[model samples]
Target: MELTDLLAALVAADSVNPSLVPGGAGETEVAGVIDGWAREAGLESERLEETPGRPSVLVRARGTGGGRTLLLCGHIDTVNVEGMTDPHTPRIEGERLYGRGAYDMKGGVAAALIAARDASRLGLAGDVVVAAVADEEHASLGVQEALRNVSADAAVVTEPTELELAVAHKGFVWSEIEVTGRSAHGSRPHLGIDAILKMGAVLKELEQLDRSLADRTHPLLGRASVHASQIEGGVELSSYPAQCTLGLERRTLPGEAGPEIEAEIESLLERCRQADSEFQASHRTLLVREPFEIGQEQELVGLVAEAAAEVLPEPPKITGASYWADSAFIAAAGIPTVLFGPGGEGAHAVEEWVSLADTEAVARTLVALAARICA
Candidate 1:
């Protein structure tokens, strides 16, 4: 099957992450569709369900052995499509293919499959593994499960990088802070403690922290950052709110200690306690993904660079992605991984698309890279 057609089928599969959007289709159907494609292409494929109802598909074209193993990874699930009209219907406009997951990215998945298929036909000395994982839009459970079951000496994450060699990207930790207070009627000011009002201090502290983070910069990723993502509090207009919860994420640079970040939050909370003895608050970390970086001299990175140099008209851009990806997880697990893929814009936005010409270029480059690296 053609790469474009395969990507269209994938985009049409409704693999919206259920965790991110209620009643979302999840990756079951899309995994099955990929499984069918892999089988028809003469590869060994299997469905892995690390979390029930969320499935990932692994398609392998085994080699003759005694050579390095390479994993081509892409996320199968996409964010919610609420306002976009016909998000699933893939359409080509100029050089781009428009669809929800096209850029952010089922295009990468399709490119990986095509590359793997071509490599399989050539009978390389090392294996080519193509993985389409679930839950990347929320938690990385699918890739986590895949790491436990499958691994490679090196990996290439096809994550919409505009065909750049992303050797580094930021990571983030999810945290939630809860401020507690006593609820009472609006008329009884002395009897009621307003948690919503108390959260003001927390927000101010977070703003300061964000500014502080900006001062710490990385050459590839630029600066560390923090932001409040969601907040909830209050019950009724007539009563003082008893509790307020603030959910936030801090983007960490490579080598930033997790404990130190926690300490920073704790110190901010301590400041609140010092301001008011009765101030009650608690902080907890929900999840953490370490930032990833690799030297451009690494063999896998150099191989892809060489391949991209040959395939692309302009020299391949080696840079850092602004967003986090499964590359962090895979690289953290001791497998050298880098992000490389076709680029478009509007990830998680109302409109999304991928460059068809660039997608084909990536597929061709991957085929050559796999042949060389897996030699």
Candidate 2:
């Protein structure tokens, strides 16, 4: 199938991943479409359901027996549309195909499927698998489910990497801190405790955490990070809040996992709790995506580098992904993985778009890499 048709079919399906598209049901419609497409193309495919009505699809073309198992991963979700009402439809306007998941990334998914089709047609000699899973925009439960079925020698998580070879990526952890206090009337001078005031130290210490972590650098991922994403507390306008909650993110690297970092943050909170017992504080881990990296010198990276340099007149940029992808899961499964995809900038925005030329180019490159690696 042409890349345009694949993208149009995908974008038009409205598979807004519930995580990115808050309140969205799932990408079941899109999964249904892809399921049919893969089956018709003579590829083996299945839709694995994590929860009822929440399903993910796995499609694979039979391998040439010897070299390696290549798993291609992409999410079937897009962030919810804010102001742009009909961002779901793919509209080709002046060399750009504009849609929600076009770049973040139905485009990547299309490219991988097309490349797998190309491999089957051209008789490339290795296993080519496509995992178009759900919840990548949220907790990544779909990918976690997929790992239960298939294991690969290596993987290419198809996140937008500007057509570059992504050898490393920082991990992401979502956490929340709750601070409690005694609610008091607004008119009272010292009758009730203010939760926000109690958390003043927590916020201050959170800032210190971000700063201290930023100062240290990694050779590839550079600085780790913490972001204060959300805060909520109190009900009435005039009453002192009894409780306050802060949502936070911590960017991680090879040295840490979710539980390990959770312990560190809890330790910090423990200290704060001891200093001021009135502000009893506790934290819970909302999400933990372990940080991972496969060195540039690995076989998979070298295979793509060689093919890309040969295919493109200019060298493909060698870079690390700042955002996490299913690559981490593959790496965690002991597969050497990389992030490689087409060029596009406004991913996850209302103005998101990907060039048709880039889509075709990435498809051909994936085809090349499969051929070389399998050979």
Give me the candidate number with maximum TM-score.
Answer: 1
What TM-score would each prediction reach against the true structure?
A: 0.95, 0.91
User: In model 1, what lDDT does residue 111 have?
Assistant: 95
Model 2 residue 226 CA deviation in Å = 1.9
Name the runs in model 2 displaced over 4 angstroms. Answer: 19-25, 185-191, 235-240, 274-277
The residue-by-residue lDDT of candidate 1 on 164-229, one tens digit each, is 999999888889999999999999999999999999999999999999889899998899999999
Candidate 1 ranges beyond 4 A from true positions? none
Deviation from native of the Cα of residue 167 in model 1, angstroms: 1.1
Minimum summed lDDT over a 10-residue window in model 1 is located at 255-264
Best by lDDT: 1
Q: Give me candidate 1's TM-score against the actual structure.
A: 0.95
Q: Where's the lowest-lDDT run of ten residues in candidate 2?
A: 16-25
Between which residue pairs do clashes occur in model 2? Answer: none
Report the error of model 1 at residue 185, Å. 4.0
